[model samples]
Target: MKVIILAAGYGTRLFKDLKNDRNEQFKHLIGVPKPLLPIGERPLISYWVEALKVRDDISDIFVVTNNHYHHKFKEWAQKYPFVTLINDGTSSNEERLGAVSCLQLAIDKFQINDHVLVIGGDTLFYEDFHLHNVIGQFETIVKDNNYANLVLSYPCKDEETRKYGILETDENHKVTALREKPSPTDTASRQACPCFYVLSKDSLTCVQTFLDEKKNAPIEEKDAPGHLLSWLVGRNPVHVYPVSGRFDVGNLESYITCHKYFQQNIRNIPTYLQ
Candidate 1:
C-alpha cells in the first residue's frame, strides 16, 4: 500500500504557532522541520514514519509538501529508505493541490493499483501494530461487499468533536453519516473522523469525479477526505476502523498537550538527536 500524507497546506492558522519572525517550517526545532518538531527528542513526524515503516502493509510513503519545504522534507525523509517527497510546487494554496489532489499525484506517480493509506501530515499516531486487527474490522464489508472507501473514527470528547468531522455509524459500525463541524442538532454521536483514511483503488475514480465537479474552486477543509467519504457512503461502502491512539497537532495548544500527553502515557518516544 502507498501511504500519502497531505502536507501542502499553507498552515496559515498554524503560522503563528509554528513560526515566529525568525523561524519557518525549515528552521531547526532542536534541528528539524517544525513539522519535524520534536516531542521528546525525536522528530514528531519521525514517530509517524517509524510506525509506518514497521507496518508490512505500507510499501511506499509519499509526502506532499509546499515547494519551500520540499528540499527540507527530502532531507528529512532521506533517513528512511521507503519515503518519497513530492513538491506541491508553490507557496500559495491556490497553486498547491488539496489533500485529495495529493493522492492523485501519488496515484499518477506510482501507477498505483492497490489501496492507499492517506493521513493528515500533522497527526501523530500510536496504534499497536496489528494489521490483521485493522483488516479484520473492514474485511467483511470491504472485500466481500467490495466497498470503495474507508475512514478511521474514534470516540472523541464532545467539546473536541466540534473541531472534527463527526461521524454517525449504524449498529454494525458502518458509517451512515458524516457532519463536518456539525451544529448541535446535526450530530448524533461524538465519534470523530480523524485525518487517517484507507482508500480502495476504485476510490481514485471518485477523486477524478471530484476533480471534474469541484476543481474550479480552491480546495478547502471541506473538499478533503470528509467530503470524499460523505460523497461515497451511499454509492459505495466507506468503512470505519477505530484506532486506539492518535493526535492532531496543528496549533500550540495541541502541539504541547499531545507531546506531553504521549510522552508521559503512551510508549516512550525515542530521543534520536538529543
Candidate 2:
C-alpha cells in the first residue's frame, strides 16, 4: 500500500482569519500553509508522516502540494527519504488543481499500482484511529471483492451536517449514499465522511473517468474529493469505518482547538511521534 497526502489547498479561510487578527501572536502564521502550521512541537503534517512510518505494508508516501508552498514541503520531506513530493504547478488558490486531480497526479507521476491510502494533510484523528486496523478492513473487503474501497466516517451534530459530506450506510456498514453538505432535513443520517480513503488499485481508473465526465461542469462540482466519492458510491462497493472523532484544521478556531488537544494529551496519543 502507498499513501497520498493532499496538501495543495491555499487555505484561504485560515489566511483571512489570521490577516484580520489584532493579536500580535498570530502574526507569524500569516503566510504559513495549513499543513505546515505548528500543532505541538512539530508541524501538523509531520504527525501523519510519523504514523505512516510504522506501517510495514506502506511502501511509498507521496505528498501533493501547490507551487506556493512547494519549497516548504520539499524541505520537510528531506527527513523522510521514502516520501516523494509532487508539485501540481499552481501558485495560487484560483489556479490550484482540486484534491481528486492531485490524487490522480500522484498516481500517474509515481506509477503506483498497489492499494492507495488517501489522507488530508490538514486533518487529524483522535487516538483511536489505527492505520493497521483500517488496512485490515481494506484487506478483508478486497479478499471478498477486488474493487472494494474503505472510508472513515464519524457522527456529527445535526446542525453540523451541512458543513461536511454526510453518509448513509446499510446495516452491514456498506455506504448506501453520500450527500455533500446537505441540508439538515435532507437526510436522517449524521455520519460525516472525512478525507481518509483506502482505494483499491482497480478503482484508481474510476477517478480519471469521473473527472473526465465532469470536465465541463462547474469547478465546485469537481473541487472537493467528497464530490467524487458521492459519485463513486453508486458505481463501486464502498464501506464505512466509524471512529470517535477527527479535527479538521480549516480556520483559526479549529487550529487552536486541535493544538490544545494535542498539547494537553500528547503522551496518551498512540500515534503521536511513535
Best by lDDT: 2
Candidates' C-alpha lDDT: 0.68, 0.90
| Residue ranges of candidate 2 with Cα displaced over 4 Å | 268-270
Per-residue lDDT over 172-221 for candidate 1, one digit per residue giving the tens place of the 0 to 100 score: 77888888877656676888887777777766677667666776765674
Error of 1 at 237 (Å): 0.2
Q: Under the 3 Å rule for N, CA and C atoms, how many clashes does model 1 have?
A: 0
TM-score to native of every candidate shown = 0.85, 0.97
TM-score of 1: 0.85
Quote the lDDT for 274 in model 2.
Answer: 36
